[model samples]
Each structure stands twice: as structure tokens, then as C-alpha cells.
Target: MNKKLLLICALISIAAAVGYYFSKGPERISVTQYKVAQGEVKASIANTRVGTVKACRRAYLAPAIGGNVAQLYVKEGDKVKSQQLLLKVWNDDLTAQLILHKAQIKANQATAKQFCEIAAGTERDSQRLSRLKKYDRIISEEQLDRAATKARADRAQCQAAQVAIEIARAKLEIVNTDIERTLVRAPFDGTVAEINAELGEYVTPSPPGIPTLPPIDLLDISCLYVSAPIDEVDAPQVKVGMSACVSLDAFAKKRCSGTVSRIAPYVLEKEKQARTVEVEVKLSDAKDLQELLPGYSADIEVLLASKEKALRVPTEAVLENNQVLLITADGVLEQRQFKPGLANWNFIEVLSGLKEGDALVLSVGREGVEPGAYVRVEE
Candidate 1:
């Protein structure tokens, strides 16, 4: 009887050991967690591809009539005003022509004055002869007729001289137009970004239907904007005057605030690339405008809608079906379903089934992070 009782006791001890081992539970996982809080949530869209920082006004300048570059008034990085002379092609011939036209005009004016004086004297003589013939008959009819013919001829010569003066003036105007064609002027206030010709170098205007490098590149850095492309799916949500943020790859720390200024009327369909619509965002009053330049790589985020002081969760913390893995006070993972409102890449608005001050598992992809599993929140 004592041996049988001891055997029963041994089996009972083995059973208790097995139960203790089995009840120890699954292994605990260390995971990152985010505490729910009231914050701003935005519905925004970002560029699908890289965008560019562009000037509000950029101009590629070249002379209308090409010739040897006679003078370069501006160098790269020179600030210029509207109508400021930038360059002048070789125009010594045109200048000479202009001087000749001026001289011809002066000469024609002098000749016109001389001829008009002669015409005035001739008319007086003809009037005296006509009075003598009509009232006193002191001159022969043939002599009076000859006098009238001379007066008429003088008057016609005077008119011809005046027309000659006008012709000379018209020639002067033509010369001036040609001279302007050889000169390049700033179309707006900007900085000279490039100069393709030096003194005495031949520069040719671009032929029709063929593009060539411009002699000067002007950029209006005082006003700058960013042009980016968003996927066609997100294009409809963007509109003019919407607030936006611009980020330049060169200025990583700065996010220049801007607004939607324009949207392209058509979508771009590039081979092997997703269809995208071009959008332009203009800076309102950026203090860093001076530092930006055209052609700088940039990205933009257009805010479609925003909610302030809303129950928000890190977007990554939310899982499939609007669910999130919440960390219970006892360090156990609990799955909770919530209705979401506005969402963005950074945060999501929690419309229901959540509250401020709740802890959620941020690293939901970690092993053993399933609901009902024990968790150790990483400090």
C-alpha cells in the first residue's frame, strides 16, 4: 500500500510539472508603439515623379538678326532691369547707314527750304504779272502765260523736295529698326543666367522650326515656383489656390509654403511612365527666394483637406480593414477596428473606436505582434 501511494504521488508531481510548462504562454515580442494624440491630419497628394524648381518668368534670349557679337553688356549672374541692354551684335554697318540717313534728311530739309523760298518768290512774280495783264495790260499775253508756267513748275519742285525729305526720314526709321534687331534687351527684370557669345563671336538666330542654344538665359528669381507632376488619379483633387508645400532636394531642411497656381489642361503620357498631370505651385512669400534657382530638383505636396485637433494615429500603425493593434495596459496586444476620416502619408484621422492617449503598436509587422499575444514595448 505505501509503494502504490508513492507511485500515485510521483505521477501527480509529473502532471503538475507538465501543466506549469504548458501555461507559461507564447514568447513576448518587443515592438515600437505610438501613443494616440490629438493632432492635425491632412489629405494630400505628392508628385509621382521628380519635379523642378522653375522661375515664374524665364526667357531664352537671342537677337532677331544674327551677326558677330559686337558687345556683351551682361555676364552670367548679372541683375538686370526691364529693357536693359544685354548684348549687341556687330552693327557698325547699320550705324553707318543710320548716320547716312540722318545726313540725307538734313540735306533734303535744306533743299526743301530753298525750293519753297524760290516757289514763294515765283508766286509773287506771277501775281504781279496777272494783275498787270488784267488791270493795265502792260505785258504781252505770251509773257504772262510763260510767267504762270514758271510759277507752277517752281511749286511742283518744292513739293517734290518735301517728299524727298519724307523719304529720307522713312529710310532713317528703317535703319533704326534694323539696328534694334541686332541688339538684345531684357524683356523683364531678371538675372542673366547665361551668355553664349563673347565679343566678336558670330551668333546666329535660330532658324524657323529649328531650335538653337540662346545667346542669353534670363531668369526672374524674384518670383519662383515649382512645377511637379501628380498621378492622373490624384489630379482631380488638386485645384488652383490650394495650399501646398514645396521641398527641394538641395534644401532638404526647408519646406517652402506655396499655393496651387496652375494645373495643366492635359495629362502627360510618356512611354513606360505613368500618366501624370503637371501642376504648378507658386511661392507666396518665401524668405529663401533668393537661394532658389531654376532647374533645381523639387517635390511638392498639395493639401486637399485638413482637420485640426483630430484624434490621429500614425498611418503605419493602422492595418487592414481600418484595424490597429492596440497595446493594452497589461502589455497585451488587442485588435481594434476604427472608422477613419482624412488620411495622409504621415497620419490618419481616427473618427471612431479610438481615443487620445491610447497606445498602439507601431511596428505591426514584427513577429509575435498578433492580437492576444504578450508584448514588451520598447523604450
Candidate 2:
């Protein structure tokens, strides 16, 4: 019985030695590890939301007067300069009114001339009054009185004809003005966005019921904007004149540069997250830019900030409550808790609980491993 007990003890000692050899004894990770270094780490919040690229100022071009669209000189995507003729209206009525007013003015001028001629002759005779010059001894007082009365009536008739001419001219001017307005011109330099009317199409005015006229819309794409409604929680960090980078799904490979131009004063409710405030971003290169539509699907990233030098560690290495397993000088694994700062998916800033020259673990799967646990460093 004594010899059997001795053999069993020897077997137990050999098994214990084998187990210790495999576990590598004193505390060390079975995987390769990197030394904690003091370096910079960035705290970034990325949003996977989409937005649109729009113009800073858009326009809706419409005709001043309503009429049948007699002709359209421009179409969609046509570039136009300020005061350039855009479309025309049927101006027959307005033209006719101008002609009639001109005729009336001519007639009134002729009548006024006739009355002036008659009045002049009478005034000349009155002025030459050699017989009436003999005080109280006129050759024919009745004749003199008739001459004076006729001259006065002629002068009055001439004045009335002059007034009639003025009225007719004013009427003609009004109609002429309307006729000139029939040719619609671009109020500014822009591109014709939509042709709401075609040739001979009876397009009505916006005021409604006035009459049918040329209809169209124009917009200026010289400068564009991307209005983003950033959440109120993130808005306070956003400021005017901050730089931004933008990408579009349509132009997936292209990148657009811009800056924050404005921010809304008040917050508004949004369904996806919480209340948000509107932000306007001004594109840097909008002049002569092509392929960017007024409303295009976009992905925007605003650079809030960056850190050049920060202490960083792999996020996977951190355990619960920001605890870290650090290898000690005595080759034992020690439990450590650190204060965490800004972090991304793979890395976090080590605010505390770690020092330079300390080794870090790749993962926290040390279930059987505890504080002061024996371990071996993997090659």
C-alpha cells in the first residue's frame, strides 16, 4: 500500500508540472502586446445621415403681364444674362391700343393747329385797331366787339385741343408701356429651370384670372448651399465659418468643399433623433460648376475638432468600467481602471490608470485570468 501511494504522488507531481509549463506560470498575456504610448487621440462623432445641395438664393421667374405665350426663346438648362429676353406674349391688343391713341393724338394736333391759325388772325387785326385808336370814336364798335369775342373763343378752342392731345398722348404712352412689357426679359443672370409654357400655349398669370401669358421659372446656380439641420445637442459645437467636407452618392468619388455660413437661432423637432437647428453651408467652388444639381443626395462631414497628441489605446483592450489589464514589473497581470476621454470605434484616449512603458492586452477574454494571475507572454 505504501509503494502504491508513492507512485500516485509522483504522478500527481508530474501532472502539476505539465499544467504549469503550458500556462507559462507567472502573469503574462498568451498573445503579443504593445506598450502604452503617449499619443494623440481624436473624439469624433460620425453621423450616417444624408442631405441635399441647394442654391444659396433661388428664384421663380414669371411674366409681369398675362397673355398667350406667343414664343419661348429659352428652355431648361439655358443660360441667360440679366435683361436678356426670355419669352414673348401675344401683344396684338396692346399694340392696337397704341396705334389708336396715336391716331387720336394726330387728330387733336390738327384741330389745335386750325384753332391757333384762326386765333392768330383775329389777334393781328385787334392789334392793328387804327380806327378803334380814336378814343370813343370807333368806325364800328359792333365789328370790333365781334372780332374780340371771336379771338377769345378761338384761343379757348385751341387750349382745349392742346389739352385733348395731352390726354391722348398719355393714353398712348400707357398702352405702349404694356406693349413693351410683353417681351419678358430675365430679371437676372440665371438658367431657365422649367418651361411652364410652350409656343402658342395659353399660360395664365400668377395673379389668376387676369389673362393668359408667358409662364416659366428660372433659377441661379452660381452659388449653392447645403442646408443641414444639425441636432441641438451637436449644434452648440458648430459655428459659422467652420470648414466642412461633403460627398454625394451620385458623385460618389467627388468631394466638395464648403464652410458653415449660418445657424438657426431656434431648435425644431425632428423624427429621427431630437430637435435640431438649421445650418447653411456655402460651397467654395460654385462658379461654373456642373453636375451638381439643385437637390442632390449628399453626405456631409463637419470637422468639429482634432487632437494632435493624446494618449490612446485599443478600445477592445479596455474592460468593463474602463478597466485595463496591465502586466506588472514582477510579471503578474494587474487589474487597472482608467479614465476614458474621446474615442472612436477601435481606440480610446487613456486619461488615467495607465502609464508609458506599460504593456497592453489585445482583448479582455481573460476569464480564468484574474489579478495577480500567472501568465506567459506569447512570442
**What would the C-alpha RMSD of candidate 1 be, to one decimal place?**
2.7
For model 1, name the residue pairs that clash: none
The sequence of per-residue lDDT tens digits that candidate 1 reaches over residues 1-379 is: 9999999999999999989988986568999999999989999999999999888899999999879998899889999999999999988999999999999999999999999999999989999998888787668989888888999999999999999999999999999999999999999999998888888888988898999899999998889888999999999999999999888878766564788999999999985658999999988776757588889999999999998888999999989999999899888999999999999999999989998899999999887779999998889
Tens-place lDDT digits, model 2, residues 11-49: 999999999897875434464466787666655333334
Number of backbone collisions per candidate: 0, 8
In terms of TM-score, the best-performing candidate is: 1
Candidate 2: which stretches are off by over 4 Å?
1-49, 119-121, 130-136, 139-153, 180-182, 206-215, 252-257, 269-273, 286-291, 299-379
Q: Among all windows of ten consecutive residues in candidate 2, which has the lowest summed lDDT?
A: 40-49
Cα miss at 16, model 2 (Å)? 6.0
List residue ranges in candidate 1 displaced over 4 A: 1-16, 140-142, 328-332
Distance from true position, residue 187, model 2, in Å? 1.4
- TM-score result, candidate 1: 0.90
Model 2: lDDT equals 0.74
